[model samples]
Target chain A: MNIILFEEKEISSTYHIQITDHRAKHIVKVLRSQVGDRVRVGVIDGGRGMAKIVAIKPKFPFSVDLDIQLETTLPEEKPVIDLVLALPRPIMLRRILSQVTSLGVGRIFLIDSQRVEKSFWQASLLQNEQYREHLLIGLEQAVATRLPEVSIYPKFKGFMDELLVKDLDDYSALIVADPAGTNTFSEALRQAGGSLRQGGRVLLCVGPEGGWVPAEVDQFSGCGFSICTIGERILKVDTAVIALHSRIMALREIL
Target chain B: MNIILFEEKEISSTYHIQITDHRAKHIVKVLRSQVGDRVRVGVIDGGRGMAKIVAIKPKFPFSVDLDIQLETTLPEEKPVIDLVLALPRPIMLRRILSQVTSLGVGRIFLIDSQRVEKSFWQASLLQNEQYREHLLIGLEQAVATRLPEVSIYPKFKGFMDELLVKDLDDYSALIVADPAGTNTFSEALRQAGGSLRQGGRVLLCVGPEGGWVPAEVDQFSGCGFSICTIGERILKVDTAVIALHSRIMALREIL
Candidate 1:
């Protein structure tokens, strides 16, 4: 873990907090931190700064006490991209959640597609906010505090017809990834008149393993979503997400 | 699997081949191919075309007979990029092999580094060409035939002082990834006067999980390797590989 993250409720006082969970074990066993040593720490959806280790048990049920000091500077830049993904298998979903979170996203929409297997929707990872742990793991990896909101839509029509229509104005551009797409991502952004630096938000839609059916592609096209291709090579769902996100982030940096 | 791959030695006569391996099982079970059905097929380091299923035994110990027809057209374009990676953990190495292969790389050099665990050098994945299976899986996913060459270097200095010096003239640019890098990837590329479309080969070097030590970074700098960063986020080793590769490929498309 790059940073130790704690929820707002975990703070016991103004400047002192004790952690006895995995973070404590990580600090003791992995980091091998000693008393008086300062380590990076962040409050979820809050500030980031250093925490001075005050006490350490370094034994079973390991615990660590820290004196927190958060920087008053501006918060980290919010992510400009959002994702609309067809629910993958539970195993892949778990990995994608952590990886994408590390890459940074404003929000995630796990929606249904015709090619998505019905059994995937029944996975426990999507139940009772079980997915939040994966997101938290991502935040730790990225050394950031903001947790991206995740919403699930089990019905493809509902997601496309209702939610998308309501959220259309929020994004400067809507993009759907397709292997057969004629336009590259940059070309699609140019064609749509979207500029990332101009406070424009991008909503990228990635389909299931089998890819979007022709009718589904037509639906996306009807909604002003530009079809874009990364390349001719077909990647797995998790790899595609990371690759696309990386490309977008790079374009943002260069453009 | 998007395409079934066959070794050159597996071809019988001139245009016929029989398969009773995992590929056959995938055809019978996952693809559910029937007699006379044509499926995409490719010969390793060879041409890609269609294979008509002539006969099939769908039961356990499944087998299939195919009549192969390779197109006379030229083979797929070779990858212009190569990778110099610090050995990661075994599981992550497996994923990286397949993911990087799918993304397209001409060669892979897995070398030791200061932060790389010593045990990683002994992984079976690095021995007996056992890693070829992951590469083939990647080829199947990408529907391409050319297999990238992989080499292992257990000693960091040997790789740097010997192999890299011999291969220095082959690449137009050499890049080393560092989180503290002052230049973005595109800036480094421009500084190196490298253009991907001009048949320029780029060699990308990625460090291990804990990152390269100062001495290693100095070694890279001494070799005319431009230091570049993807962004501020600290991604896992596997995620970083995919992200960096994706950014390079995207830049190739746009530039």
Candidate 2:
């Protein structure tokens, strides 16, 4: 973990925190931190700064006392990109969540598609808030504090219908990834006259392993989502998401 | 696997081939091909075409027979990007191999670095060409016929000295990835005047997890390598590789 993250409730009124969870274990073992040593730290959905290790109990049930110094102002969380992904297999879903969170996506919509196996929706990763661990892992990797929000939609048609009724004007462009796309990502962005730099968001839709069925593709197209390709190669869903997000972030000058 | 791959020796004089290995199993179980059905197929380091299923013995030790029709001309392997990576842990190494191959790299040089653990050099994945399986997996995913070549260097200084002796005139730009880089990737590309569109090769050097030592970074700088960053986020090595490769490919207009 690049940064040690703490929830708001963890910090005492005196700006002192005692961590005994995995974070404390990580600080003790992986970081090898000692008293008076300052480590990079951030508050969840809050500011980032450094924390001085005040005390260390290296015995069983390791604990660490930290004196926090958060930035006066919170970092603005204006993530310009969002994802509408067809739910992948559980293992892959975990990886994608962590990877994309590190890439700084604002929100994630795990929607259903024809090619997505029905069993994937039953995965424990999607139940309760089990997926939050992966998201936190991403946050820690990136050394950022903002946690991206995730929503689930088990019906493709239902999600599409909801999109029709929602306010999508905040999005400057809606892109759907497909191998058979007529235009490349840049071409599609130029054609759409996307204002990505002017505080506008882009919604990227990715398909399942076998890809979106014809009707699904048409649904996205009907919703004015530009169908685009990253290249000729058919990338795995995880690879595709990272590549697409990287390219988009590059275009936005964020990466 | 998106496309089935075969070796050159597998095809008979009559252009017929029989498979009894994992490919045959995939055909029978995963692909579920029937007699007279055609499947996309490619020859490793050769051509890509379709194969017509002639017969199938779906019993124990399942096998399949196919009549092959490959393209007469060989597809040119003109990969423009190469990687100089500090050896990562074995599990991440396997994923990187497959991921980078799918993204289309020319050559991979796994070298030693100050932060790289010494044991990574002895991984079984690097011995006897066992890493080929991961590369094949990548090629299969992309439906490509070419395989990337991999080299290993157990010594960092030795590898740097070797680079000095070898001719690197073919490379238009030599990049070294660093979080403390003075330029973003695109700015560096513009500064270097890289001839990516003219088929000039780009060599990207990535550091180990904890990053290159000052001397190592200086050595790369002395060798005319531009130190550049993908973004502010400190991504995991595997995520960084995929992200950096994706950005470079996008910049080259190849993706």
Candidate 3:
């Protein structure tokens, strides 16, 4: 972990915090930190700064509780990009969550697609505490305090009918990456760049492994989503998410 | 696998071939092909075509042998991007090999850097056949015939002094991604887009997880590499590689 994150309730009086969880073990063991050593630390979804280790007390046979003093923390800047992804396989989901969060996405929607495996919805990675673990790793790696909110959607049609379509009103652009798309992503962005509306936040949609089926593509197109291609080569969902989002971030000059 | 790849030696006659390995099992079990089913096939480092299953026989308890006819095939096109990367952890390297191969990199050089773990050079993933396995998976995913050539350099200073400097003669442009870089990747590409020279190939260098030390960055800078940044957010090595390469490909109209 690059930065240690703590919840607001965990902070003690006099700006000192005591940690007895994985975060404490990580600092004491993995970092091999000693008392009086200053390390990068951040409050969850709050501010980030350096923390001076004040005490290290053995809490269990192999774990320790750390007392640290927080100093000179600053509020985090908000993230710009948000992703609406077809829930990937559970293994891929874990990696994507950490990677995309490190890449600074503001939010993520793990919506269902026709091609998504039914069994994927039952995976434990969707659990809030479990999901939060991956995002914490991401935030620590990026040294950022803001946490990207993650929401899961298990029914494709229901999500589309109830929220996906309406959520388009909040974004400046709604893009779908499709292998069969006639226009390249850059071409689509160039056309949309001239007249972006709303909060300048782009809501990008990436499909599952086999990609969006014909009806799904048609539905997204009907919702005013610009269908675009990366190229003829087929990329795995995780790679495509980074590739597509990175290009958009580059073109927007946000990266 | 999107496409089944065959070595040149695997072709038995002008139009026929037999497969008894994992590919054959994939064709029989995963794809569930019958006598007349057509599947995409490609000759490694050669052409791509569709193969029709002519015959199938059980080779072992779980394996099968198949006779196939290649109807038509065309020569593969060349790839535009090549990479120079600091070898990541073995697990990450496996994902990167497949992802970049799927994304269509022409070549990859896994080189040493200040931040690279010395033990990484001894990883079994560096074995030729094991490495080729990952690349083959990538080519199969992308449905491409050609495999990217992977090279390893264990010594940083030696690699720079001997090969990296000399290799600069071959590429039209050499670009390195650094967070401290003055220009964004797009800005660098826009400048180079005006006058791309010799072979239209760009050699991209991406650092390790912690990134290049100042000395290493200075050496690369001295070699006429345009230092470019993706953004301020710290990206994992794999994410940065895809992000940087995708932007380059998009700007070049290759994606």
Each prediction's DockQ against the real complex:
0.83, 0.66, 0.63
| Stretches of candidate 1 exceeding 4 Å from the true structure | A73-75, A192-194, B72-74, B192-194
Looking at candidate 1 chain A, the ten consecutive residues that score lowest on lDDT are: A188-197
lDDT of 2 by residue, B83-147 (tens): 99999999999999998888898889999999999888889999999999999999999888788
Give the CAPRI class of candidate 2.
medium
Ignoring the other chain, what TM-score does chain B have in each prediction?
0.96, 0.95, 0.91
The Cα local distance difference test for each model comes to: 0.88, 0.86, 0.79
lDDT string for model 3 (A1-255, tens) is 788888877777766777777777777777887777788887888777777777776445334334555554554666767898999988899989999988888879889998999999989888755888888888888888788988777987876886554676666677888988877666666666755432377778899988899899899898888888767888888889988887787666521
TM-score head-to-head 1 vs 3, winner = 1
> In terms of docking quality, how is candidate 1 classified?
high
RMSD of 3: 2.7
A best-first ranking of the candidates according to their lDDT comes to: 1, 2, 3
> What value does DockQ give for candidate 3?
0.63
TM-score of each: 0.97, 0.97, 0.92
Please give the range of 10 consecutive residues that has the lowest summed lDDT in model 1 chain B: B188-197
As for candidate 2, its clashing pairs are A230-B255
